[model samples]
Target: MTKPESAEQDHGYDVVISGASLAGSAAAILLARRGVRVALLERRSDPDAYKVLCTHSITANAYPVLDELGLIPAVEKTGAPHNDARWHTRWGWIEPKAAPRGPELPHAYNIRRSTLDPMIRSLAARTPGVDLLLGHQVTGLVREAGRTVGVRASAPQGEREIRAGLVVGADGKDSAVAKYAGVPTQRHENTRFGYLAHFRNLPLDGGIGQTWFLEPDMAYAFPNDDGVTVLAVLPDKKHLPAFREDLEGSFLSFIRALPEAPPIDGAERISKIIGTVDYPLISREPTAPGVALIGDAALTSDPLWGVGCGWALQSAQWLAEAVAPAATGRGDLDRSLALYARTHRRRLRGHQFLAVDYAKARPFNPGERLMFSAAARDASMARHMHLFASRLIGPMRFLSPVALAKATAVNIRHRGTAASARPRTHSEP
Candidate 1:
């Protein structure tokens, strides 16, 4: 794809992207690759803006997108390879090895947000036909005849108006673009709070990320490129106060209490503890006439699975592909935005629905119990669980009758064997 020629004047661009984070920058790169001019706006002046409160684990499914954008080599230089997943549950530790997939579909990558975000933003700036605007915060959307045409932004230079045929909202969970564009959003009340920090000297199994399902409360530790590791805890709302009082101490204690805890006991803290309270996972329709939303701005899934970064990049790619022809004047902008909206909803709604349902803090449903129990007992079941976790299969596949029946049979047989091995109880005289 050839790069588009830049507009001679500075008042407008082919597309105006609000928020220069992962999603926005990725969209800019994709648009530029397809010969579409883009103006990427970010509130922060620094090019190296970082999202401090993220786990930054990109699943294997996202690797193809990164490779297609020519970013895998650059990202791999700063990120650690993540290939295996170790689940610590009441039953036992279930380790799922990476499937023997080709290099195109390798395992996961664990890169700190501090490093990953900046790298992608820099690439966006360097891409031809992309105008990277920093330190500019958008305050309002410009509408022409009831359709979005541009944005009203405020920067140190003063207020300015930049017009574009298409406007994309990549601002984030508390997105101003969605609000100004009048896209209705429904929020699920997630009472879970998360606390995370980086540490050194933590003993982690090489190349594997570990998650402890401490029923009700969950903890995860992922090793990154540098000697640093990210440890996060998702605690019930009631226990939030203790975490707030002593952030570092409480975070360590929570992880240590897990059944097969990560070796944080001898670890030295490398960063200040960060906490998000009552962070509900939210989902919203991502488009309107001449406007669209991507990433967290579109749908906020539960962070428990570490899917935010991957989903953000993936959605950005989807939006860029869907809107390219319209931005180039070959197709209608409204139709393009509508198609992008439908595609986003179709790809994400089912996944988000199931995630939000499980976020309700209820005990595992029968299907979940059966699947996990089977994974604990058999390697093949573990591989199936991995495929589901990595999102290679849809929810329907995971919940299919055949899969459920196999899991149920495994669970029942195991229970029967345990029951037969137990000594019989006798009545006392």
Candidate 2:
């Protein structure tokens, strides 16, 4: 690792990034690779600290970035499962089967945050030109002439002021940098509360991930590293009291009641049930002049889709790609910032819209019902659903005119068959 240049003495770094977790660290590494200096600040003193309340699923769409970062081999070595998902709907199971000679299906990874966070952080620390400053918490932003220029942080040594060409807030949803920068944000209510726990020896066929869309409620069993399975439930607020009364019991009951449920009862429970009763969906302006936000700081959509970790990686990549030329003194930083913001919004807006709408815990609308049922009955429809649900494609493509037509035709064909198969009661005696 290169010695971290004194940020204050070096006329400031190219970028000062808050939060040395997934987004922050990855941004630092990517920027440094593009010949820019970065100061990656993390509040936690412990290098091994990890986020406990995360789904920890990295969607397949993010694999390209991971491969570029030289992390896929390391991630696979951690025993994380390359997971394909199957959804249980009222109509039936919407599982996309691979064609015999077709290209390999896309798959995500299920790894615990405990292992992933520190791994990425360590990689960032070793990368040249990245100052992974642990135990440094951003207290405020440094603004000059109404533009954010850097950050004010409290370091283990003492209060430190780090100036930079750009400041990035990679901190979580409650981003102090965003707050201090006065970044415009939107918040939406999530009517569903969540609970999850880890278990050992859970019998899931082929270790494939399973999800149940029980109308207003949802449940999942995701096989993770080290032979552990994560069982999670997201129930509407109407069921909060029961969950609050018997958190473990209610969680288990809700999961066990699902069709083709995992053998949780027979499995050995490894972690206590963790519950999050209220989590607001948040979206912030991705960039402001010299300041940029990534990961949860930029957008905290519903976790039901398990897009957080993947988005964190991809957004960091996008920010680094957008600003690297500017940071390296080849372009205008403001234009770069605008590019980053535009790219971020373009890639995530549709996904966020759909996620926020469903976060209300509303029952399936006609469109949702039509699509989900069609997905269960038709392989091509199921493949499209799988791609969208995996965050591999945008909503526009998933709900394209062609997709809608195919779904309508499949449903109508099924409807006709059902009517023809119906038995008639004796009439006109």
Candidate 3:
């Protein structure tokens, strides 16, 4: 860990990043690769600080960035590869007919944050020109003439101000950097909470993730390494009292009540049930003059899709690529930051919109019903749906008029055939 030098000391750096988690650490590594000096500040004293209330599932889309950062092997050691998904609804189990066999760009990884955060932190500390500062709590942003210049932080040694060319907010959803930078955020209350825990000795099939859609309530289980399974239940707000009374019992009951969910009744618990009442929040803008926001600090999506970690890593990579040249004095900083803002919106707006709408607890819209039903009936449709869900394909590909029409036709034909196959009753006696 980097020690906090006195304010008078010459500790010049090109960038100062707050919140030394996934986004912050990734940004530091990327910038350092470009030969830019970076100061990475973390509030937690423990260098191994990980987000306890996270799903910690990295999607297929995030693998390229991890590979680029040379973290694939490290993460693979701690994670299990996840590909297939099983959705249990009133209609029955909608599992992929076969494993998605194709040119695997990067499948998802089921990892626990406890193992991931420390690994990335160590990597950042070893990267040249990167200063990893643990146990430093940022008090506020330093602005000069309306431009973010650096950050004011309090460490065990004492209070200090660190100046830099640019400031990056990689903090989580409730980011102090965003607040002090005066960036406004838009939050939608879904009136739901999530209870999550890990279990051992569970008979969970590897290579697949499971999601039980119990209409207003939902439960999902992901098989992780070391014969552990991560299970979560998203319940409506009306059931808060039951959960508040006995967290473990209520969570277990919720999972057991789900139709076709694996029998977790006999499974041994590996961790205590933890609950997060506020799980959904979306920010309006991710960047400003001289400062940029990454990860949950910029925008938050519902955990139902398990894209938080992927988005965090992706956002960090995007910001680093956008700002590296400028930080190294090869381009205009304002132009670089502006381009980053636009690119961020272009990449995430559609997905975030869909996630926010779904977080409302509304039933699948006509388009969604068509797609899901088609995927349920046709293996080809399932592959396409899987690609889209994994973020390999853009949303436009799934929402195209041709794709929607085909899905609608398939769903209608399936229902029609089922109706025709039913037995008829006699009219006369």
Best candidate, lDDT? 2
TM-scores of all models? 0.93, 0.96, 0.94
Off by over 4 Å in 3: 4-10, 97-101, 104-106, 423-429
User: Can you write out model 2's per-residue Cα lDDT over 1-429, one digit (the tens) per residue?
Assistant: 323223344345899999988899899999999999898888887889899999878888788888889998999999999868899988989988776788778886899998999999999999988888888899988888989878888865677788899999999999999999889889999999999999998989666899989989999889898888998999999999988898888988998898988887899999989969999899999998889999999999888889999899999999999999998789999999999999999999999999999998988888898899999998888888978877888989888999999999998888777668885443210
Q: How high is the lDDT of residue 349 in model 2?
A: 94
CA lDDT for candidate 3? 0.81
The TM-score between candidate 3 and the true structure equals: 0.94
Compare the candidates by TM-score and give the number of the best one. Answer: 2
Candidate 1 vs 2: which has more lDDT: 2
In order, the Cα lDDT scores of the candidates are 0.81, 0.88, 0.81
For candidate 3, list the clashing residue pairs, or say none: none
Q: Model 3, range 1-429, lDDT digits (tens) per residue?
A: 365433334379899999888899999999899988999999887888899987768887888888998988876776565645777655556655544565543376888888888888899999998988888888988899989999999887788888887999998898888889899999976666898989887775544788876666778888776668899999877899888998878888888777766679888888988878877667758887779999999988888788889888999899888999998789999999998899889888888888777787766766776777787787667767777777777789878888888787877777777768875442210
Q: 1-429 in candidate 1: lDDT tens per residue?
A: 112222224544899999888899999999888888898988888888888888778876677778877888887777566645788776677777544662232466888888889888899988988888887789999999999999988877777788899898999999998999999988997767888889888878654788877666778988887868888898877887787788778887888887767778788988888868877888888888878899999998888888888888888889888889889898887788788888888767878888898787666666676788788877767777887777667788887898888887877777777668885463111
Query: What's the candidate order when arranged by decreasing TM-score?
Result: 2, 3, 1
